[model samples]
Target: MTAEPNFVLDLTLALGTSAMGGYIAHRLKQPALLGYLLTGLIIGPFGFGLQTDVEQIQALAEVGIAFLLFALGVEFSLTELKRVRAIALQGSVLQIGLTTLLVASVSLLSGSAQTPLQGIFLGLVLSLSSTAVVLKTLTERGETSTVHGQVMLGLLIAQDLALGLMLALLPVLNQPDAVGLALGLALLKILGFLAGAIALGRWVVPRLIQHIAATESSELFLLTVVALCLGVAWVTSKLGLSIAMGAFVAGLMISEIDYADQALGKILPLRDTFACLFFASIGMLIDPTLILNNLSTILELVALIMVGKALVILPIVLGFGYSLNTAVKTSFGLNQIGEFSFVLALGGLEMGLITEQRYTLLLGTIAISLMLTPLWIALAPRVVDGLHRLPMLKDILNRAEEPKLLSVPSDLSDHVIVAGYGRVGEVLVNVLLSRGYSVLVVDNSETAVQRLRNRHVPLVPIPFVYGDADNELVLEKTRLETAKALAITLPDPATTRLVLQRALAKAPHLDIIARSHTNEEIDVLTQLGAREVVQPEFEAALELGSHLLNTLGEPPFDIQAVLTRIRDDRYRTIRPVAQVGEA
Candidate 1:
């Protein structure tokens, strides 16, 4: 029998170590993933050997990939992906081509006995990086909607596709005939898988999820979703495809289903908890001792691959008539190898297509490149700015307005100010905007900022000067002096009172409206200088209580629409508090 006590001990230690690492990384303002990777490095066989059950952990890690890809596929539809086909496909292809050429040239110069096929495999490995790493970094920084974020996500999608193909065709290419047949067969196989999944998910899965959700137990919902992910994984593997490929296919099939969304929501609570284990486990596979002994060669390959790959990607994007900003941003994003690299390296090792040494080098190099991406992106603005200053290249970037010091009066009569673009603020902004009053918004959510920017809303473009509304800086941005009225739509009563106090001191004559969820809170804010205190629940109850007196069949209080209306405001805060500043 398996050692149950050992299993329990291992899990407890893994969870504790991983949690500590995540907390530490969260405090450091870096991706929690890096902390998990570091944790694995410390606890792996090389360090504490706490994860003694390597086989079991590997199996779980494999399951995590299947589930993760399934979720990605569910979210990434073909239609949405097609919009950025230019950036994703061409960029990924270029990244691969130039990276391979550079790596092969370096290998040959270094006197490695690697042949053409080995060179191609090595090139493939060098071209890929840590998907989990780069994506987490992008996500943590709140850059997903930026032009660079979209391009980065698209290329990652393409990388996933390329990885699927490599997983399919690489092993089969051991023979020349198999090489010719592999592409067609793999394509046909993928098509069949896609067709079958679409039919099953649309027709059959919704009924199953509704039945599960009807029970209203969150645990059952989560369990059923995991089963679906793993069941699809097992089914796909039986068809001679990778489990991840199956997971992705299953994800795409369920993209349009209502049950899919519900089931997925339940499946993804603390997803990265297990997913971090997946990344950290991969890092554990790397024996840093071997990496240390060959530090010179590793550093040389790292520089060669990064610089050479960037050179290859630069001209291609520039040739596409992307402004220097777009071109440079595109290059910086692709400069790092990512998730696909790990997939390709491990697959190559499994197929015996690459030697163990090459595999280690490839993994270590990709890891380093991924770790460097955040710094690269952080420094990109200055680099692009410097490049933009050149006349020949200057005309390429999209024009953005140069910000000027907006001098408005410190206090005003009958003016408007919105705080926190939440549900109530959304409706208030729309109603106020329809009246054509000059509306000033203060919020810290980056997502909200991008959304408002996309709509070209007539509001001050800067993020909230301070994270907390209680701060003097944020109140200053709202120009307490220039406003005739200020509406505090944020949920927190303490914050509303704090803003009211600041407003009274700064713009004593301004009318203040504070939104509160409870009557007691509203009473407190009114005492603090708020001219009016509106409770959303009470407002809804009043409206419904009125409509109930007349329409007879009006739908019960629509909490969702009320919430949506609140979001429709100019500051309808797209910038969530979770994803704070610039990515």
Candidate 2:
């Protein structure tokens, strides 16, 4: 008897292997996508050849890309982008243009491209960095809200926005005479699509989502959201643009609606599931033998791409007035070729702009680069610290706009030094100022420092230092020896730890209050000499629990006692710890 096709079995194998891989990656403290990719490499045709339905898996992977971009659109924040608009908008443009010019020039000089158009196509392909990988890595490191993180994300957003134009302009690159017309037409198409999307978001989508919510059937709500996402993607594909771009546009439309959070919550599971297939499919394309044979060449290309891209990006960020630390991290985070480069490479191959061999080489280089991104980012802090330690590099790296200070006493002693000017720092400063405490703020963000300068505190002038508090020089400027206390409220844990260590090294007897993002961090910070470590979430939970007990007629004295015990123990009772052999 003939057997029917087993797409379900194929799906099961793919997802099962992906989950195992992801779990292993998590245990190793690496990005889970690396695990998914390795899984694909093992089971793909070029490896053990366990899966027969590779094409079907790839088709599903397209949905993964759509959902990935869709979720990005939903989470996209205009306010965050606005904060780094100068670098995000202008720096991205400069980066793309410079990278393309440099790559094309090198290709021509090396005789790698037979024609200028081919060289330019190669440049465009290499210019884009992987937004998916970088964003995932940043989120994992808990650096999404930091200055460098915001800058990297802002530049990435600009790149994604430019992707629509790249998709349109790539097809006509061979026809040099028609390049201008193609660009103009592409711009018009993008503008038209955006205008229509804005109109719909402002009028149609909200009403439709509201109506869907009224039904109170979650399945219906999800289906409608998916339909809108894919429907828009389909339209963009028909318009000779990418479905990914269309999906992002659709997400942006939903983001403006009141139900954005609800839509995001409902779609996250599907996005994650499909996104696994997408990353795995990329792994499936790796021909292990090809890489083994061309190992030396691929390694050379990988180093060239990463280092060259970093060189191109570093100055762009610094020239935009960002700190060296910010620039270095941003450069490291975005030096790799993006996944979308694969799409562009395929288009170039179809148009005969590059050979099949060149296409394969580019694919291998991109995959390796993407795999290295997380590890590279993890090492960036060390690189920055090393640079700072060098005598010659120290001055240039720390060179930034002079600190803008407000009214300050000549003898700024017995004052509190706040290490961050973010949400936590702002509140702490206000409280200290209102209570007539002298305050000095240290922050790296120019925008945050400007906000401090613009503060109308009546008679209380907000004196501040505009630099990374983690740096010894910046911390020294805070007058740690004479400060009453140090409040470490930096969002990045590494930076927070560094600031705490440096502060104590300068003033061993200073009362220090530190903020911790995780339970594990509370223990680490406390052990590092922080007099008190506060986990905001745990504090919020304790407050809520106390209210609940009060409403239940429990004595306030007893509630306080219970809270004091938990606090005194550094939250050991509530902190979750992995048991032996848990993994």
Candidate 3:
């Protein structure tokens, strides 16, 4: 007997293929998103014809978008949202307005749109930048806590909110007379939903999390968090909003609570899985024939999106009083068209505002733009640096404002510079302070800086410098040249290396103690000019050996001598030696 087609088999094949594609992309040092999209392009009906059940895969892909939005919401904190609120709100509005006008004008001039409605729709589609790509790159580069990073995140948050409004308006754009009334009603409904969610978040959600936590059941806690995410998503759909909108609201609700991190941890796996599918499904929609035929059009639109958006955004960021370095970086980071553009394209297709061919063009442009984001970000800093070297541009580039240089006593000198304020740094600070040594603490975490500021310790002089130690400006602000010693305790190996190089360049004579995770890292850090490198593993091993020796009634003097010898040999005696031929 012949078997019927099975959707389960197709689903497994799609996911499995996406995994291989993602792995390949990772190996190439490219974003897994590119691989996921390529997977869809290959296995989709247009290529190998593996995923014949496209509709089912697309349905599951919707879940991926919801989870992506939900995770974004969880990461969105009120403090960060508020920090750049003015710039985020105003800059988003300005960027959207300017981009729409520019693109709509171009669309009209180029005959891309048959009607004003279509032109407006097309313009809005190009206005947004991809939050997923920008955030992922920023986090990977460890720039999420930097000045430009904050600005980029703030603008993305603003754009996400703007996207919801655009989605609300798209359905009614075809109705000229009913447009205002429909928008008003929609806004009212959204505001009402938000108010209710805020009330619930302020009371019910936190209590629910508390009760769930009290159960001491991690499974129950995770289950409840998922329920809350889906429940809100359903409620939003019922209220005539997108599921993505609901998921974002759900995230905002959980973000304000003590369990925000826990909720994020629980939802991340599902979010990532679904997000991969979402990106891959986007890939599935690409028509290879259409792209080959419209290569010129695709290239033209990609140039417009990559170049036009950056030109528009650079001035907006500059006008916000940000340094040119930050402005250029922010603009470059946002040069790509976003995933939300696909949503708008779909809505436009549903409303008959755009043809299938145009939709194909939009998808191709967005995919190409996203593919270029990482490269653009990598080159942005160097580009800005080059521009600053030009005689005329140098003055203009440096003219923009820098982070407020905090005040320290003029006589502050001979202090120890602590490069991180995490657990290890904190302990070191306490020990240094108790000995009457002045400590200059530098950290990139805003929360840590704020906490240190608010801490009420009368007569204690802990000068906290709020910036990334990796930045030369931030390092210079610490007056490392005058410091007696430097401690590098940052968790990231690359960042530690960067800070070490920068610090040693400025103060070659500074006594530097560094932390390493492995024997290789210990050697590498010492070679980088660290006066002493402490590997946690060998230290733990020594402690354990000392304890064992004491239990065996070995002499205390002998134990001290053994530990001292191990330290003198740089943990050589305790570490297993590699075979001479081993790599």
Clashing pairs in 2: 130-338
Candidate 1 whole-model C-alpha lDDT, 0 to 1: 0.65
Backbone clash count for every predicted candidate, in the order shown:
21, 1, 0
In model 1, state the lDDT of residue 148.
Answer: 56
Evaluate candidate 3 by giving its C-alpha RMSD to the native, one decimal.
5.0
Predicted structure with the largest lDDT when compared to the true one: 2
Residue 539 lDDT, candidate 1, scale 0-100: 59
**Could you give me the TM-score of model 3 versus the true structure?**
0.81
- Model 3: pairs clashing at backbone N, Cα or C within 3 Å: none
Whose TM-score is greatest here?
2
Model 3 weakest 10-residue run by lDDT: 398-407
C-alpha lDDT score of every prediction, in listed order: 0.65, 0.85, 0.80
Give TM per candidate: 0.66, 0.92, 0.81
Q: Each candidate: RMSD to true structure?
A: 10.4, 3.0, 5.0
Better of 2 and 3 by lDDT: 2
> Model 3 Cα displacement at 563 (Å)?
11
Better of 1 and 2 by lDDT: 2
Sort the candidates on TM-score, descending order. Answer: 2, 3, 1
Instruction: Give the per-residue Cα lDDT of candidate 3 at 310.
Output: 96
Question: 1-583 in candidate 2: lDDT tens per residue?
Answer: 6544677777888999999999999889778989999998888888898878899998888888788778777877555556899998899999999999999999999998988888888998999998777876776687888999989978887787687788888877767788898888877887787788888888999899999999999999999999999998888777666777788788888886789999999888998998888888888888889899899999999999899999999999989877777888999999999988888899889989999999989989998998899988988888988987799977765555334443346789999999898889999998998898989989887778778777867845688887888877777778889999999999898889988988899899999999998667887899899999998988999999999999999999999999999999887766666621131
